[model samples]
Target: MLGLKQSDLASKAMITRSVLLGLEQPGRKHPDQLALFQLRDALIRDGLTFVDATEAAGEGVRWAKPSGKVWVDCLKDARAMLGYSLDELSEKSGVGRYVIARLEKTDRKRINEEAARRLRDVLFDNGVVILAEEADIGAGVRLRSRVRPAK
Candidate 1:
């Protein structure tokens, strides 16, 4: 719609043409964060508000999840918005790369409280909000940082 063909837009957005076509058609699944943001920016440049474009695009989707895993997702979003990388975050936060990798993966079970606190601080310093909630687990300790933003 920005004087560019669907294929051109897809290429510019670094997504496949099928994704672009799917976004154009109604009732299709919503795009991921990167794609959604790229489309949003393009639409805004063409005089459409981001909220309106997002609403129009996701008209039929009953629920849309936030991007990223709690720790990983928050870090990714903050890094992207703040123009940093995993290595930079590790260096700045003093969290090991292996720990960061494990946290981003699905197998993560436990994270030290200190590490979690440090991560929260790093993300907050970058202007990202970190919300940690606890859920009950039997009669023992509760689970922490269960739900996170999508990547």
Candidate 2:
């Protein structure tokens, strides 16, 4: 996986983080083809290759080549998909907001494992799919549906 901040990736992809966050929602409508291509190209430059489903595995993304640096944890992706602000997630999960932010940045040093578990549980309970490693697919997260009803 590549290690780029949302703002950085959005810049390279010619998209905004808000757009990237919207696209992450499961069951959301697709963006324009040009925007999609831009995002794909940006990710390709970051060493990801989009995979197509076959007999051995399902459609997903894979590293096109070895890359260094730890990527942001799935927590941030799931949180965005669920539309929960860090403060909201912290309150719901009973984890400190600071710690939640740290986890999102992949800065887990001195972080409590129990606190992280609690945070993950909150995300899972509210319709986020915490994907585990399967076949060659890496661990990731997705939303099953939006967490709250639309206004």
Candidate 3:
């Protein structure tokens, strides 16, 4: 989901690929807590979320939502958080201004993958990191360390 290879993830997590693979393999012993937490946090930083099983759904991985709110709000909040006006976001994302306007105004508007990908890339570039919902925590966006909130 994060489009990361084993080596890439291992490097990001500061762990050996073999150790990461061991953790993935069934029947193998779990890695040490520190190693596991390191890997988890690393993945989280890159927009991967681990979900526990609930009565309705089995345990699985979910990509962070592209934006913070459900639909229109998501786009607006993401843009606001990055201090990007619709025009700036449109320019940065290579998406048309009209499309972004429609996205922010229309409720439950569905966007094609390409457009979504464009916006997502722009958001990430500006430090708006989306996180998937967990058992008790809801999905949201977080700024990277270097990103300051807009005044």
Candidate 4:
């Protein structure tokens, strides 16, 4: 489901394939907290968000923010959450400043996948999590950490 091979995910999570398999199966004993943390980190690093179960809905995954406002607003909001300027984002993402400016200032939907990927990667790398709307969780942006470390 996370687009990762079991062996690759196990390696990334620093756990054995048997352990990962155990976690996947329903009847096995739950993994220790450290193993779970490792797995969570591996998934989160790839932009997979694990929303906790709420009264309204069971747990689920979100890839990006839900559609509504222009996607460019989402980009700008994420950049703002990371306290990065357009120029700074451009430098970090290797996306042109004009492209970013247009995204932020206009409602154009012509951005290529690679360009969008670059923008999203830079924001995610900076700890800005773009959450999609779940059954109850509304779409929004939040930082993984309130006090982010220097890049």
Candidate 5:
């Protein structure tokens, strides 16, 4: 989920790899509260919602369904927020210039979901998160304060 490996997740959360592995293990649970909080915060920032156990449902993670229109409206903003110009976005996302323009249009234009996903994945991988629209609140685009050190 979220197209991430365990090592990537651990790095994002700033948690040690062994600690995260222990937390995931069946019998070797790691009860580091601070690490748990860090991981939770990182996941939340990654466009996931955590559902607590209810009478009818067990605790689970979910990616909220973003409003398509909202996503379209903000595509350009997201690309720009990443400090990527149109050509840069095209290169990174492998979405054509025409498609990007069409998706950014206020009026409906034909563009498939796959193209959108390609663009979205680039933004996600680059630390931009598109927030899902909720009742009484409109959708939003947020830039994570992420700065990974050079390898």
Candidate 6:
């Protein structure tokens, strides 16, 4: 439940209330990608395990099933675990608020290589371990990483 109201969940999930209501009802079609992911994370925080579609549909679709927790989720959790806010992270990392927000939200489909490297360095400096790997893209390049906070 994450202590969030239905309307709040809908707003955060970027879907309409009716859509969220329908998703909550039995036998209704599941929410789309964004909403589903958001709802799954919220549920996970509340100790609920979500059966990811990518896992169930394995190999049929080329979807990257989120392996364990996502890097962004790790970042958010690490920050919270350290009792740091976005503003504090921004100041500590010397990364701008907008840039940090963009990274956290994954607003862009791709991030600049230099930016990604700098982000990796900053996170590492903050006791967060991050490993980046280059992924094959048809034409463009992609970077994938696993992140966790150092204990």
Q: Per-residue CA lDDT of candidate 6, range 6-105, in tens?
A: 8987776667888788777646554566767776665544443322223222111111232343344234434543456879877887777677666655
Go through the candidates in order and give each one's C-alpha lDDT: 0.50, 0.69, 0.66, 0.68, 0.70, 0.49
Compared with the true structure, model 2 gives a TM-score of 0.59
Residue-level lDDT tens digits of model 2 in 1-151: 4667888888999998898877766778656677688999998887666655445333445455433322235677668757899999988998889888888775466556787688778887886655554555455555544334365
TM-score of each: 0.41, 0.59, 0.45, 0.47, 0.49, 0.37
Most TM-score-accurate candidate: 2
Name the 10 consecutive residues with the lowest summed lDDT in model 3: 65-74
* Cα lDDT of model 5 by residue, 20-96, tens digit: 98777656534788988999988888876654544533343445455444665667766765668878888888888
Q: Rank the candidates by TM-score, best first.
A: 2, 5, 4, 3, 1, 6
Candidate 4 to truth, TM: 0.47
| Alpha-carbon RMSD to native, per candidate | 13.8, 6.0, 14.9, 15.4, 12.6, 12.4
The sequence of per-residue lDDT tens digits that candidate 1 reaches over residues 74-139 is: 444344434567788789899886676666544567756677678667766655443322231111
* Model 3 spans > 4 angstroms off: 1-73, 146-151
lDDT of 3 by residue, 1-151 (tens): 4547899999999999998888887566546787798899998898756655445433434455443434233556567666798889988888998888776664544766577667877887776655445554445455543422255
Q: How much does candidate 5 score in TM-score?
A: 0.49
Q: How much is the lDDT of residue 72 in candidate 4? A: 41
Tens-digit lDDT track of model 4 for 19-88: 8888877565546788889998987786656555445433434544333443344677677656788899
Best by lDDT: 5
